[model samples]
Target: MPEMLIDYYKAIENSSAKMLEAARLKDWDEVVRCEGACAVLIEQLRYQSQQQELEPAQRKEKARIMQRILRNDAQIRVLAEPWLTQFEHLFEGQLQVMH
Candidate 1:
């Protein structure tokens, strides 16, 4: 059971890593695709979590995996900031023309 939980976390970490790579490459579409995959994994993890508990050692490992996932997410957000700003500007311009 603990191993299964760890596997889920590992899969999420892999998805996050892929997302980070896509961000680094400036491939927003690929990043979004990986984000969707991560979301599904997260949902599955949530359901599995309610049905099982991790042992102490596995808990520590899970914490480490979560930390890496968070770091990847943070970097992805940073990479996205400029693109988001540009998208917002485009929307603002459209709004002004429509008014």
Candidate 2:
């Protein structure tokens, strides 16, 4: 059976939530994995959207899901900023060592 548009929204939301959880734990790998999943889901959602539109109720639900996803994303970014800065410094140090 073909996937429903609402299902895609739900899946993306789930991935986003997982990303937030992983970020809270400082598990960057898991966060990356979930981010990848969200990317794939969002791409699929875009394609599926062209082929099918959500019902009015589904559209409302999608809006709610999107809101949660955005909130999760904000939290993830806040948690990740410091880790990303540290990683960037480490990478720069490694490059200096090579030189």
Candidate number achieving the greatest lDDT relative to the actual structure? 1
Task: Evaluate residue 12 in candidate 2 and report its C-alpha lDDT on the 0 to 100 scale.
Answer: 91
What TM value does model 1 have? 0.91
Q: Model 1, 58-77: lDDT tens per residue?
A: 99999999999999999999
CA-lDDT, candidates in order:
0.93, 0.91
| lDDT of each residue in 19-63, candidate 2, tens digit only | 999999999999999989888988998999999999999989989
Q: Which ten residues in a row have the lowest lDDT in candidate 2?
A: 1-10
* Clash counts for the predictions, in order: 0, 0
Per-prediction CA RMSD (Å): 2.3, 2.1
Query: Candidate 1: minimum summed lDDT over ten consecutive residues — where?
Result: 1-10
Candidate 2: residue 23 Cα off by (Å):
0.6
